[model samples]
Target: MNTQIQRNYEAAKQIYANLGIDTEKAIVKLKDIKISMHCWQGDDVRGFLNKDQDLTGGISVTGNYPGAARTPEELRQDLEKAYSLIPGKHKLNLHAIYADTDEKIDLDEIEPRHYEKWVQWAKKQGLGLDFNPTCFSHPKSDDGFTLSHPNKEIRDFWIEHCKRARKVGEYFGKETGQPCVTNVWIPDGFKDQPVDRLGPRERLQASLDEVFKEEINPAYNLDAIESKLFGIGSESYVVGSHEFYMGYGLTRNKLICLDAGHFHPTEVVSNKLSALSLFSEGMLLHVSRPVRWDSDHVVTMDDETLAIARELVVHNLISKTHIGLDFFDASINRVAAWVIGTRNMLKALLRAMLEPTESLKEAELRGDYTTRLALMEELKSYPFGAVWDYYCESSNVPVREDWLKEVKDYETNVLLKRD
Candidate 1:
């Protein structure tokens, strides 16, 4: 460890100790929190299906940066590089389209054997795996509908695909000894206003019921459904709007996935955590940054991101929340994007864990609003960087901006060589 970093951490430890916070314990807790890193970021949301299909649905990757992963091996290698730079042992979130097989198999025909290599890889690396049923970017879903499609055949196809995805999630969980969260998100809506709104929602609910009919062991798999306010093509109405899924999740007793970029520009996901945790068994978070729309930009250490971490720590909701990154930025080094986003997430959680929660709670409970607000503002200027630096150092990862050089070197040596 650097002498200066150690000195700074010592000083910060003293400062936090004065506030009744233990910086060492904070670091330990931060290490325990695992953020699920999405695999789509390395390949620009393009999966290795050995097909030439354009990205459809309401989603799109903006940039065409060089060296995007072309095969499953390359994507896994990039992810390995990324995981090395991140601090904790995190989970890898995979979509159904990323099945590691050369055989020509339809989505509905996919089986756990298709992902055996991924399971083995995760076991080798000691990483947990989460899953998503890919309901977009397919011929059957080109009309911006899947589970709620007007055609019964199309709806059944998606339902079967999701059923298979749950099996894969079960496989991951049983193999990794952790509950795999299998999330379902579909772009079923209209680009223009539709005459019949209730029809699609009713169909969606029925289809979901069919999909979840075969309940896997809760110890092996957890089901979650995601909602979106709007998407690029579905600007007029999204069938799976927040209101729709909130009702569905509550009624169906499933996890509700709240994507940071899936809401209105002004809406903050951090504020919703507490209220949702009240009734739900657990929740899933798709943490991303949206500039003006649902852009899926890489996450940063911004105010909203920090607030999310703060809320999770303050409310003690970390155990009930499954945090995951949900962004695909092909504009820059994909490995760097992963490292930056994951590290920033860890930093936010570390900052939250280091807060003087007891004092803050005491002030709030006693109706000492003035002291609470003042302390909240004062805590912002604390030496959070020092503790974070110490964390990276002790965790055997790069400290501060030093990880950027390693990513640059990787781009030169490995990524740029790819045709």
Candidate 2:
């Protein structure tokens, strides 16, 4: 082994020791550390890799919005860059272009490049490619796609979009070593009342069925069919958290992707285990922080949120999930947003390994697992802000000057600290 790699092993071993994880199980589980490419350099994955930060050898290619290949050479160059960034022992997840909604929600303007060149280039680098097929065009879908729209024409348009995306995905799967990913986060739900009670659910099911029947089965592969949720929109446009419950229960796709930040400040309410319970099996988790009700805070997990988020992971409520680094803080410096986001996720995972005082079985038998485990939530008598502060203080992260002081003021003013 390289001397540098050996040093990293030693550092990780010490961390596991502090966390009370058995070294044997620690080594095995530590291998699961994964992060998204967006947090480092968007499409420019190679630019961020170095000996200083251990890139988990995993990458999730952002859809071609900001990082669209301006020319064929650019695409090839990006492919080469991504391949070079794959950590020696790990594989990169090259995602496909989803429809761009930041602008006017245009889909036709953003057509996917032919799979031919990508396959050829990825094959040369021994790279893997994943596809994200999205449909937000079509006038009928102006209100929503897949689920809410009642029109057949809109449904057909979405199906066609999936067909094109899946065709390219199938080619990539055949040529590249990685399976293709079909990711969709439809903005579909009713604001008022009355078009069709079951329109959203039926349309979503139909669209997925069409894709599975036509594209996935023919390819003789079952990669992941991830259903995403929410993009900033009118209140009329936003769907509640239950939408995920409906999507997961209705769809047959075994693996589910959960965007932790999409739940927004409500995630402050749902907690991590409650979020994981929506889907029994999880394939990917988009990790980021939300504040003041914004979806793209892109800030790292604060001390309080991390405490709650990790307890869920350690208990086996969620497993086999990749981190998406799902943040888009346009206000902050771009690189800074990503850097903070990635570091925060790493810290949250490490903090989560903090061993429990009681076994999971013991907690369950005593009925203290889900809601009770959220120490912040348990102190209802105290002011909400004060209870939140107490949880942050107890999380035990070393560096938290900005957050700690602000919450400390609230705790001192609001709650009477126990002697």
Candidate 3:
């Protein structure tokens, strides 16, 4: 243990103990909460199969960062480097397009065998895996319509892809001993206003129904539906709005995936977690940062990020909430982006766990808003960082900004060496 880190943690632990917050227990609880890292960040969302395809469906990776993982082996190597820096074991979220098979196959023809390599790697790393159907950035989605396409043929095509994607998720869960969340998010709407808004939504509803018609074991694979307010092409009307998924998920017994960047600037995913927890058995979260719209900026330890983590801990929704990172910033070191975002998320959870929620709730219960407000405000300046540094040191990972050195070295020796 780092002597300085241990000394500071001791002082901080006493302070938290006074507030009836067990710092050790907080660390223990945080150890169990794992954030699934998005694989798209490694290759800027340009999956191995469709290297030539330009991303569509409002998805864009802006920077021309060199050394983007060009193959499954490279991506996994990058992920392994990233995981080494970030403390604790975590899951890897994969898209259908990242299939690691020598056999050339389209998204609709995807199967569990295609992702066998990913599962094998996950098993070796002791990490779980999550899956998503690649509904965007493909020829089938060139018109920015999938699942809700007017052509029944296209809808069926996507539906079959999603169905297969679920099987892949099931394979992952069964293999990893952790449940897999197969989230469905499609860009199916018009750029301009259409008179037939109801028609597209109805079609989307039917498409999702068809996709999820086969009931997979919930223990192995849990289905989730993610919605967006609007996107580049679908600025006027997005077929799968928040309400659409909320209704469909509740009635159909599917998980609702509330993304941080998928809503209006005024709306926050943290506020929705508590409400959604009431009706659903579990919910999936795509934690991201939005500059103005759904920009998918790399997550920082911002107010919203902290709030989102706080909701999970405070509302006791940690067990029911499936947390996953959803940002991709190619301008910076891709591996560093994963480390920074994931560390921030864990730090937020640590801070949230350190909070004296029971005492605050008691104050609120008695209408003693002054103590509640004061305590919350004061905790913002607490020695949470000391505890975090100690946690990092204890976890055998770098403390504070020390992890940056490893990333910088990796960039020089490995990432930059790639063509």
By lDDT, highest first, what's the ranking? 1, 3, 2
* TM-score against native, each model: 0.98, 0.59, 0.99
Please, what are the lDDT tens digits per residue for candidate 1 over residues 239-270?
99999999989988899999999988889999
- Output the TM-score of candidate 3: 0.99
As a TM-score, model 1 comes out at: 0.98
Over 4 Å off, model 2: 1-28, 38-113, 116-128, 137-148, 174-176, 189-196, 215-234, 237-241, 244-251, 268-283, 303-312, 317-319, 332-336, 354-419
**C-alpha lDDT of all candidate models, in order:** 0.92, 0.45, 0.92
Per-residue lDDT of 331 in model 2? 41
Name the lDDT value of residue 396 in candidate 3. 90
lDDT of 2 by residue, 170-255 (tens): 66666665555445545565445445545466556666666556636523233344433335332333432345444653356444
Give per-candidate clash totals. 0, 2, 0
Clashing pairs in 1: none
Off by over 4 Å in 1: none
